[model samples]
Target: MVTLAEVAEHAGVSASTVSYVLSGKRSISTRTRERVERSIEQLGYHPNAGARALASSRSNVIALMMPLRTDMYVPVMMEIAIAVATSARAHGYDVLLLTGDEGPAAVRRVAGSGLADAMILMDVELDDERLPLLRDSARPAVLIGLPSDTAGLTCVDLDFVATGALCVEHLAGLGHRDIAVIGEAPAVYERHTGFAERTLEGLRGRARDLGVRLLHRPCDPGYGPTSATLARVFDERPGTTGFVVQNESAVEPLLGLLRQQGRAVPEDVSVIAVCPDQVALQASVRLTSVSIPAEEMGRRAVERIVAKLAGDDADDVTLIAPELTVRASTGNAPG
Candidate 1:
């Protein structure tokens, strides 16, 4: 009989990867899955019948808790949800979306009712209200965002702190000292959402280190609100020549507003953003930005949950590194 380790070696992957492929317990790339299946065929490998039967005894579903809030950018959230759903399906599991802000009640409900074998939480707070229940629950759970505490939790997310500092570093390196951070909506910051909070923390901390002035204004979605925020940024610091925008909705509007004020991009002012690649590319100005790895976050969350189910030792914290792409929107500061 061909062993799992032999099959893994044949497929050029780890033994756990071969097991995950056979068990359908984790999301594997189509190419890798195909290669593994081919290796299994060549080796006449058969998965353990007893283990498959035991795995089938559970609900085989994963619950995703995501609260749809007005302050959030829905497209990015939906993109992540779709990624999670797709990845879960690839692992031979169905997804049950719990899109309500039920807090710990949802955690308790899912765990107590045996509704799902595992859970993946989104829109996490630094001090999430549901962490206590999740930590104590017998079920496996994964968080797509980091929290302040991770004593007994598995989390996967972008390193927003590095992202913030990277954005500032890019602008400051170009000689733009007074920078403005047009951030997410007031409600997002008020809620202390993990991503927003971390980005602000990194931006402020790095500004202090670099001896640069950072102006952060939380702006609502829409042209009027963005315009208002921009006016205030200039009002407070008329010398603001560089921008680090975190809000997806405000990117284009800020650019348009700046253009309307007879300011040529990179000539009079520079703009950099923290957003998805498509957003950065599609902007009126091809935005210099740090791409948010939403799909990667969703994918890693599923892998962690599946690894836990497979009784493998998974890391408690997984942070994807951020990379900044410089494009046409930013340039040397004016004298």
Candidate 2:
């Protein structure tokens, strides 16, 4: 293994000179710097990240805590994760992906151990258990999902409330009076995930204002659960003429089930989704939908954390506005 001492000896300079050249803490003469650089290249001497972090007090790493649960869609989570990783890299930081459901302990461990300079949390519940620790810790954190309270936190997410309301308004405007929301899996709602709850809040609130009858059904991912949920919605509201689906797993199943039941989309019923644009476009039916801005949310979360790390202190929740695209799958209610 090549050491700094070897590079220093080879360059005919002191070890301190090599340290200064690597850290740029102090200016060195151009000739000396060039000679050290040549020696470093020739000897293949690389400064250790741990040593650099200890000296600078910054690891230049971000910890992303994302719990992989079966109930939620993996692709969307992966999209956001990829975005976060790439964005962090662009900002000269590496991502330490912590896929455990470590709750608050993960934060304490990472923050205390100096393994990462900051954190970005995902799959946030409305009243998250990790918030208190994050609030008290001096280490910077940014959430990709919004919590019920944002008083002392930085968060970035899609405006799912507006997302839900937009779906309702789109269907309602098409004269669909009875709208059914195909929500996330039962466990997701059971845990009171912030996005799911807020979306429901907006759906119910807007439904009341628009005089639209709304039925919400929490469905597991796959054909069987979606089929059963659809049956229940139809049984409860026989006049149901619209659907607002938030589950990516259920989109194709719902579309297929509707077809099997002899219902033509936009002719007998209209369906819209709250999902990514890729999901909307690739569905069995090109869905009229509110696109989830995963990339933007991920990028913004990193930006906020980077800003905070640089002592910017601009702690505030950022909600990306929802954009609903009208595609092939929506139209007026059945006459």
What would the per-residue lDDT of candidate 2 be over residues 1-335, giving only the tens digit for each residue?
A: 78889999999999999999987889999999999999999999987788879978999999999976857867778888999999999998999999658888999999999999999999999999999999999899999888999999999989988888888999999999999999999899988899999999999999999999999999999999999999999999999999999999999999999999999987898999998899999988899999888888889999998999999876898999999899989999988
Which ranges in model 2 have alpha carbons more than 4 Å from their true place? none
Model 1, TM vs. native: 0.83
How far residue 7's Cα lies from its native spot in candidate 1, in Å, is: 31
Sliding window of 10 residues with minimal summed lDDT for model 1: 48-57
Question: In candidate 2, what residue range of length 10 has the lowest lDDT sum?
Answer: 67-76
**How many residue-pair clashes does candidate 2 contain?**
0
lDDT of 1 by residue, 1-335 (tens): 77888999999999888888876879999999999999999999976544543656567788999876746767778888998999999997779989757778888888887778899999998898899888888889999888898888899999999999988889999999999999999988888899999999999999999999999999999899999999999999999999999999999999999999999998999999999999999999999999988888888889888888888755489999999999999999999
Scored by lDDT, model 2 comes in at 0.92
Q: What's the residue-level lDDT of 12 in candidate 1?
A: 99
User: How close to the true structure is residue 225 of candidate 1, measured as C-alpha lDDT?
Assistant: 96
For every candidate, C-alpha RMSD to the true structure in Å: 8.5, 1.6
